[model samples]
Target: MKTYDILILGGGAAGFFTAINVAEANPRLKIAILERGKDVLTKVRISGGGRCNVTHACFDPDELVKFYPRGEKELRGPFHTFASGDTIEWFERHGVELKIEEDGRMFPVSDSSQTIIECFLEATKKCKIDVLTTQSVQSVYQGENHWKVDTNQEQFSCQKLVFATGSNPKMWELLQGLGHSIVEPVPSLFTFNIKDNRIKNLPGVSALASVNVNGTKFESAGPLLITHWGMSGPAILKLSAWGARILAQKNYQFGITVNWLHTSDAEEAEQILRDIKQNQPKKAVVSKSPFDFPNRLWESLVTASGIPSEQKWADLSKTQLQKLSTELTQSKFNVNGKSTFKEEFVTAGGIDLKEVNFKTMESKVLPNVYFSGEILNIDAITGGFNFQNAWTGAFILARSIS
Candidate 1:
């Protein structure tokens, strides 16, 4: 059988990066990436609504690690080696320019995922890294000081094996057969699907709000969007990322409290509403909301608060004002289910981080084997953090292997 110095499974960001870096670092090393999918970087093409959020702009390694909800502890060491700054430099060195958005998300200057994909393809070609597509690895076995990889097409031998197959179950199963510990996988970064009139007609309405998941454990404040299905945006996505495990345990069924006004608390928000009612007492409640919420959203909130649109704030009693304040500030919604945050849904569990050496992403239990990317139990919040993990882990492993 033909032998290679490095064999990487999965042609996603991590695998391609590992192949390119290893080939560049060691010119004589024979590196091949085997991808089951017909097209490489399929997810990359669809990530970030097709803009491909390559990485976050956060430069501090410690700060960057906090974005990952799962592998924060394990990724601390890897981030020190290769973080967002490294990602920027690597892409720029290869001729792909990236720009950071106001929200700290970094995307290609071309605003096209094709830019990132072509850069990887060109880098791989320049480095002479072999890429095999439509090759599904069935299993992996250790051979004396080497690894025998069995695929649907054929079997190959490699001195080093790297699993970057993303969150695929079969990949984890293959690794488990090779005696690696894997954490049970679960969905992360999803939006809540709630059926409520409070946000029904106002599909595109969004507000800077604070979301408290059951008033404990997880909390985030950002742009909260009201979609036809339910709620989304930075606040909702952050909630999904942070409470991925807890929500999964609760079977995606839970109560979510939203502070639409983003005031300190219910009492504080109630005082603000009371002041508005007193100040704008002559105005119709629907025509003039206390906060700068959208007209449709304000009407919806008023309707949900059991107040008529024609009711004058001047005629509002203390109890009515308190009710409106409660509805505006601490509105509780039942999240009966979840829907994908577009096509960029990520999972939060994979190969347990404790079993892998973060310095090199190599398996501590098995020599000559490494793990990187989403294949491990590392998942981050939205805003390019997940892609950063892939780049960081792959870069570390490539350096160590080379």
Candidate 2:
């Protein structure tokens, strides 16, 4: 049997960060990370299309916590300890400078996730931390004075243990065996799989809009993109993240009301339509889209409103105008299923928040056993918020454990 001062399960971002920080804080303490798969940092390789979204540019801790739907209140204290600014400084100190995009997602200046991976590997090597792969953990329990972990290949014990495995059911089960309650996991950050003619053949079209799930108070407003399958982007993704459990309970079958004009109300939309009718009376209704929407999308919405291909603004009756206004302000679509957004398969459930002490990220139910990343009930919308949670939690765990 092997032994170490600290043992961290999973070799992903949270695992590596915690190990490195703990080793840095206490240079003489031995640390090792056990990874289930042969490859480590696989998620980092595909995140942000291989660019690796390190974190967001949001510096305020309170503002940062707002992005998280689950751990908002719990993370308020931790983010004050080690938030996005700390993450940026840490990466910069490690020689990996990050650049922020217009949308606030930060990526390495190298524009390659390999840079982040190499940084972690280098830090681990410098700290003399072992990263063991293909060591799938079979079980974990407190053995008197130490934490005992049995992997498929070997057995080990450590004074302190950390579970950084993100959204792994087997790990959750093993943790449950350790007397921790696991929240039922549900899919989050997915796009609605909608099949409708209003958006058919207009896959590349995008617009700033507001979307709300029917029969629920869930709502979001941002840039919405029309995909071949349905609608996606920040607007739809925010709704998905915030309503992960509710939508799953609905079995991914529901209806959504979309406001293409974003902040425009029904009355405002109708007034704008009437003004356009009076000014552009001779022009084709579908040819000149009055709003900032794509021409194809406008034509489709016009068609859905029962308007003909060559309908002029002057020929529109009262009913046709009302229909057009409704289509522009409150379009409805049926969502039959969901599609995973790119490679970001985030879940909204894990170890219950009450079972974790956010101050140290240590399990309240198990001493010396810590949790971080998606292993906890904390998840956030896209744009590097999830990774920020990982960094914050892992950093706090390192401080407490070391």
Q: Per-residue lDDT tens digits of candidate 2, residues 1-402?
A: 999999999999999999999999999999999999999999998999999999999999989999998999999999999999999999999999999999999999999999999999999999999999999898887889999999999999999989999999999998888799999999999999999988989998999999999999999999999999999999999999999999999999999999999999888998999999999899999896889888888999999999998989999998999999999989999999999999989999999999998888989999988997999999999999999999999999999989
Q: Give stretches of model 2 more than 4 Å off.
A: none
Q: Each candidate's root-mean-square deviation in Å?
A: 1.2, 0.7
Ten-residue region with minimum lDDT total, candidate 1: 288-297
Q: Rate the local accuracy (lDDT) of all candidates.
A: 0.88, 0.94
Give candidate 1's whole-model lDDT. Answer: 0.88
27-90: candidate 1 lDDT, tens digit per residue = 9999899999899999999998898999998999989888878988888888888889989999
Angstrom error of the Cα, residue 271, model 2: value is: 0.8
TM-scores for candidates 1 onward, in order: 0.97, 0.99
> Pairs clashing in candidate 2?
none
